[model samples]
Target: MENRIDFVNWLDPDMSIQILTCLDDLSDLLRVTCVSRCWRQYVIANGLCRQLCLRMFPQLSKVVHVVEQRYGTKDPAEVGSSNFMEWQNLEREHRAYAFLARGCTTFPIRDLISEPICASSTDNYPEESIDNTLEPRDVVAQRASYWSSKGNSNPAEPEMLLYKLMGDLCVITEVSIQPFEAYFQWGLPIYSAKAVRFRMGHPKSPVDVPLGESYKDYENKFIWTYTSQEFPMAQENRLQTFKLPEPVLCIGGFLLIELLGRVQRQDMDGLFYIWFAPSSLFNCSFLVFMVNCCELFQDQCASTLIEYFVILAIIFSHNVYVTDQL
Candidate 1:
């Protein structure tokens, strides 16, 4: 009877889907699917299961740029349909609104600065293109021309955003207080952020401050000697905040490109790092589901494909639990 009860519990697909959909725990559902072929088939065939999966697959727009940076492709043509364009704009506005909800009155300074620099008013291509009179190459050139006009006007390279900000010593000092991956390695890919810190200026007094002194004692001694108006307490704190080597920032851009280059290499597997915290992981999963639902405003994909991938990703994440139990 105990074995019978265990068999019934293990065989339950409705219960698996319920936990996945209700708890929003894809990892657990995924684990169950990996347990046997039956659960996988049931998930694939169920309408509600498909709907849930479709709702989770589109939360990848931010990382889309990173993928392109790694792979050297523009946004896919399929993702640029009129409906998808509207959806993309809507998502941006919605994100802005959500940030506003959390008291972020301003968006990232980079976005604000880049807008007019890279702005274009062009929408979907001409009806003639849709009607197939223009050759594919012509259509590509026309689209490129539209974007080129906007980007060429005072033409901003993306790297310029970082380089211009790099020498601004005052701003670098401010970033030191925050340990976010951005402040330490602005141009590096997100995963290479471990132990990175911000640095700004040289150590004072023409000799190294020994590592033996407590931070407070070092500060007190520096404050007394560097009394010159040029390097006051505030300036000392700013300079002291420099933790990571400044030279790393110089190599950051090239390192990013190199990391992308090695991504497909087998030996490079050791270099990949998982930096997502539990909260961030949960939030991303939720966003994927939300984007899937809100995607109706843009290029539409069949709900079935969305369902397929989301469920699969969720199942794969269950390896975490299986490993933990062992």
Candidate 2:
């Protein structure tokens, strides 16, 4: 052991951090902690594990800080926690990041919408219901099927479609929308929005907003925790996908699709209506073989940082969830 070189001791702190961060695998980082007490202290003290986790999943940036739910009996101010408190907190974060990064494998892509909650408006009740969007094909039972917002003279009057996920937590990656092509109407115009945005979160209250024909009372319904940047839509008769910048773990099960800047107008009515046909809100899921994320649910460590994505796959396997690739 005399001839062995100590990188943490001999190298500059910044250089040492850079070298350790270069390690791409979780096993490589875990080995660094096992090398010696100095290496372990340096690794945890500098927060190499949390840094790597953020590097891998930029979505974790939303989490401002980590606080253990269980606290000491005495206040930290009364008993100095500069050494022990900080060290234990660092270890907790280290363990969390390490567990989240472990055993990542390919997961099947699927739809996360449990059910359609409501639409801002409807052109013709029962005929143009939000439920029609669930059907993949534009034509259902030999008839054109689509959800159409009320013809608004003001194109600026944006429309919204709300949906619920299968679980309380969902890791959302992509959302796909298809503008409806009106074949029955003259010249066959595609009713599409200039841009679209997606929002995900949980409802503020236990009581759900009233759901019925063309419900518009969305105010104070939910607390949106995550909102994606506006994605410009196309006036075509095909599916358009807007993948999120990164995989976002949505704490709440609710999602809202806001259609902005309508571009189509009914020739007869002279009003714009954002028509949607089988808009697939695809949930890009993840699977973890090594880490039992279910256990993290029990520990309650996942509420702030990440949640189990395997829930999406479970819904798919049950054969209730239908996701159309097109």
Sliding window of 10 residues with minimal summed lDDT for model 2:
310-319
Worst 10 residues of 1 by lDDT: 251-260
**Cα lDDT computed for each candidate against the true fold:** 0.22, 0.70
Point out where model 1 deviates above 4 Å.
4-16, 47-50, 53-326
Compare the candidates by TM-score and give the number of the best one.
2
Candidate 2 versus the native: TM-score? 0.70
Q: What does candidate 2's lDDT look like per residue over 1-326, in tens digits?
A: 57978878999999999899999777889999999998988989998888886776554565555433322233333566588777777876777667656533134337767788888888887778888888766677778989888888898889888887765545677777888899899999999999999888766655565555344576466767788899999999888888888766565578888999899989997988899876544332422222223332442433353332221111221122211111
TM-score per model over all chains: 0.20, 0.70
State the lDDT of candidate 1 residue by residue for 1-326, as single tens digits: 45434342475766655655563344454455566675554444443333432243221111111100011223443467897755444433333222212221112222111011111111132321111211213234343211111111111211100111211111110122111121233343332212222211212233343322223333322211000011111211111122221112110010000001111111233232211111111110000011111111222443232211100011111121000100
Clashes of each: 8, 0
Indicate the residue-level lDDT of 80 in model 1. 72
Instruction: Candidate 1: give its CA RMSD in angstroms.
Output: 25.2
Off by over 4 Å in 2: 1-4, 12-15, 21-28, 34-41, 55-89, 101-108, 205-216, 282-326
